[model samples]
Target: METQDGAELCFPQLFNTSCKKPSSSTTQAIILYTVMSCVSLLIVALNLLVIISVSHFRRLHTPTNILLLSLAVSDCLVGILIWPGEVFMTTNCWFLGNLTCVIFMFVSIIIISSSVGNMVLISIDRYVAICDPLHYPTRITVSRVKLCVCMCWLCSIPYNSLILKENLTHPGRYNSCHGECVIVINPISGVVDLVLTFIFPITVIIVLYMRVFVVAVSQARAMRSHITGVTLQLSATQTTKKSELKAARTLGVLVVVFLISFCPYYIFSVAGDNSYTSSAGFFVFHMLFLNSCVNPVIYALFYPWFRKAVKLIVTAQILQRGSFEANIL
Candidate 1:
């Protein structure tokens, strides 16, 4: 059967039976899957370390760090639970039975929805802290952050659960290995899922970040004015202003990286007209997978403390290994 993107494949037939031998497209898919798997695993490992280190070290447990830890945990779960099935679907084939297919697809949808929702929460958190600093302390308590995280997952459940049910009930006519489930292409359902998953969340993120940018700029200007009024005193006020500017810059970097990694996939999914051609689907899948692997690097670049922490952790690990070797000798 042909997918929406125009790649050719046999469907309703199991992977082993679809073709007598592996094809070039299959080889490419394998390579892509392998590379993505390795990258995602590396990202997961690093993020896990970040989470653990932050939790263990007293100095690293600020509210901002707590949000970062949550993001890292989500990414790690995505890497562990979602990426493996993705790799299998990309490389070997969809060999899992119907139950697994539903579970995998359901979990993946939840993870993705939660990831985007968490980003929205992060943006809102920053926006409130920067724009309404006077009330931020009272507004952004630990309980509130926890509630936000819980709400994200709660919001995700219905969307993913519906999609999962649809995939299981409506096996596409051309589906190879009818055992594996996929979202059936009903235009209405597709449009709803697209709007809920991509359109609304993306709009929220953009609006919140825009507000954040405006607030940041205003604060910077006010700080400059206050500094001038103080006869160009460059110590306390200047340092505080500089730190705020740095934080704003870091948030900007994060927003950019997020958009860069995920935009293509969303755009393609929204515009592709539901054609499941193997090539286009595979290409978009790969891009989405890349998104899961990008957060660590972005964090390192934007957060100096996180960067230093990672460095210290790595150095300590190396030293410990050396000492152990010496003892063995």
Candidate 2:
């Protein structure tokens, strides 16, 4: 009995007060940790490349790319801070103390919320470019985009601070025993989070993308049918329309992938089964984290500029003087 209890407890020395170890077998735990560690490293490395690519190349500094940069920054934080912390929590006891746990949760929420905000900004940017191309040049300037990115991040702090207020005031209040860390979102806060973060943002993204799609399709049809006379003026208009449509398609993919990654967590939350200890919750939370890893991958697939930037970065050609002015687009 003593041996069995010792084996199950996270901290054997704590005896009666200790939390139980996860029921996973030794091999399973080892495999999970190894996979998570590799993913952590990959997420950090990939997003770091994105950060460098966008930041270094001057020609890539368009309004849409600015939104991507903000997203990369938030995703990089997830890789650098959130993934490793998750790995540690999954495999070990809560040795970091309640204060540290609370701080970790706070930072994690802020980064995630900032990511969602960046996605919304991206959608809005694409909407203007596709739906209102006449004013896109003036409306979506670099300085304005930079300001929006700053606001997205700054607003996330206060927004998430409110969501995690219970944890802030009383860290570890939900812990069942020593060597454990957990957060329990009461129904009111959970509902508010669901509506604000998941439901509202997703609704806006879908609606905007739907409009973008309609406009893009109509523009494509116009170009194909040669509805307008084929003067040099018409040719120029066609080229511009094609560019806008392509951007919309690429950004549409980005938004769709983000929704795919984010929806599971909220869905489970709404089902009232988002217990942190449960397997489904664990999987969904990591699914959300995986979005950070996949964003640059999507960029590489759809954006030739990202591919070119990666090549320059990997070859160390970006180190040369005036490389920032390279024609990445």
> Which candidate tops lDDT?
2
Please give, for residues 1-329, the per-residue lDDT of candidate 1 as tens digits: 64445444544354444422224576787777778778777868877866866765556655566776777777788778767766565445455655676667667768777878777777777877777765777998777887788888887888666755556564444355433344444667677878887788889888988888887788778776776546445556467556656766776676677777677766776775453335666576667656656777776766766666666567775245333222110
Give per-residue CA lDDT, model 2, range 153-269, as digits (tens): 898888878888888899988888887767778888889988998899989999999999888888888789996569999898888888778888888999999999888878988
Pick by TM-score: which candidate is best? 2
- lDDT scores in order: 0.66, 0.86
The residue pairs that clash in candidate 2, if any, are none
State the weakest 10-residue window (summed lDDT) of model 1: 320-329
Per-residue error for 101 in candidate 1, Å, reads: 1.6
For all candidates, what are the clash counts? 12, 0
lDDT of 1 at 64: 60
lDDT of 1 at 151: 84
Badly placed stretches (over 4 Å) of model 1 are: 1-34, 169-174, 178-181, 228-241, 272-277, 315-329
